[model samples]
Structures are given as structure tokens and as C-alpha cells.
Target: MSSQPAIIVSSLDMDRIEALIEKMPRLTPEVEQLENELDRATIVAPEAIPANVVTMNSTVRFKFIGDDKVFEKTLVYPHDLKHDEQVSIFAPVGSALLGLAVGQSLNWPMPNSQSRTVEILEVLYQPERAGEYLR
Candidate 1:
């Protein structure tokens, strides 16, 4: 909603996400938002992604700006979403989290027309950082 903080995405993840977007049945606002994010991201090789940056399959801990309760979730693709804690990149919050580094915050619009600020507290696990680039 505001000027977004710069984001970094790994090349592997970028390819995968672009493919996923292409396979979607129809375009939606969330999808468009994700596309916008991808368009502006700084893409690099998977091995070069910073350890703190959130990538596909990363387990991240974050919280709403005014909320004290933190949430830890794994960022997954649509088909990989089987658990309540898994977030699909097509979801607003999930899209917002992509490529974000720890300590970055984003003002995310909600379905109800309200906005919530999401702050990244930590990246507990990142596929690139763990050397699982293909995953």
C-alpha cells in the first residue's frame, strides 16, 4: 500500500512462481499483486540469495504490526498446501511475504478493506539457504 521495501528473490524460485502463475485458471487481484512483486524484485541465483530473505518453501516467523502474537508458517505452493500453517503464494499474506527479509514490514490490504502491517521477525528456514535449491 505504501512504497514497498526492496525485495530479493532467487532465480529458481522466480522461475517456479512464474510457471505457477501461468497455470492458474484465471487472473485475480492477488495474482496481479504477485506479478507486480515479481516485476520489481531483485532476482539472483538460488545459491546467492541472502540467508535472511524469504523464498519459496521458507518457514518464516512474522506478526501484525500491532499484534503481539507471532505466526510461524511455511510458504508453499497452492498444491503443497495441506496444513493450516502452510501459506500459498496466491494468498495475500503469502504474496506479501515473498522475497521479504527479516525486519522488513509491509502494509497488506485485507478483504474487508482494512490494512494490516506485517513484519518479518525471522526466517527460520529457507530452501536456498539450506542448499535445497531445487525444492
Candidate 2:
């Protein structure tokens, strides 16, 4: 995999994600990747996060590199994931999407033994921006 761009995450989200990681007896690669990303992240206070940065409960719009298909999902905690519109932080795509800004793209690993690229088209709603920091 190519080098990932530097990313920022909120301190609250970081704490919650770390606790989640600790609860798992075994870590999947996708979850491990999320842990690693958090380790290297520029952690900031909830109110300090930029409006465009993806945070927990943020609604993101993105598209695959070659496909014309676009998708919008809310990044959520594992427990909050209820349907296709929500993406759990434990998933590979969810891990890749966190902290990404509009226009940033991540080359994500897939179960099919191939890499797929997804570019952030917009951050439709971010918790920090909406003043829903504690959510």
C-alpha cells in the first residue's frame, strides 16, 4: 500500500476508539489499521477540528476512482451502525475514511485481493461543525 496522508482526529473520538480496540480479544487487520491510524493522528479537541475533516457521526460523500458510483454514509461507532447508511469504524473503508478531508483519496484493501480507491467528495455534515461534539 502507498503512504497515507497525514490525518487529524478528535481527542474524544480517539479515546473512544482506543477503548473499543481494547475490548476486542483479537484484532482484525481493518481494526488494527484503525488503531495504527489513531496512533499517528494529530489529535485535537472536538471544537478545534476543521469543518471539512471527517469525524465520528460525520456524513461523508465519496466515490470510487474508476466507477461513477457515489456513496454517502455516516461514520459511526460500531454500536451505532444500523444499516448501509452507517459505517462502523471497525470496517476497512470506515478506517480509511476517518479524518480524511474533502478531495482526499485513500487506497483501501479489499477482501477480493485487490485495492480500491475512494476519494472524498464532500463532508456533508461533521459533528464538530454541527456542535454535536459529545455525540
Listed per model in order, the count of residue pairs whose N, CA or C atoms clash below 3 Å is 0, 0
Q: Clashing residue pairs, candidate 2?
A: none
Worst 10 residues of 2 by lDDT: 106-115
Would you list the C-alpha lDDT of every candidate in the order shown?
A: 0.91, 0.88
Which candidate leads in lDDT? 1
Clashes of 1: 0
TM per candidate comes to 0.95, 0.94
In candidate 1 the C-alpha lDDT for residue 32 amounts to 89
List candidate 2 stretches off by more than 4 Å. none
lDDT of 1 by residue, 16-58 (tens): 9999889888988878878988998999999999999999999
Writing each residue's lDDT as its tens digit, candidate 2 over 15-126 gives 9999988999999877776777788789999999999999999999998899999999999998999999999888888888898889888887766677788799999999
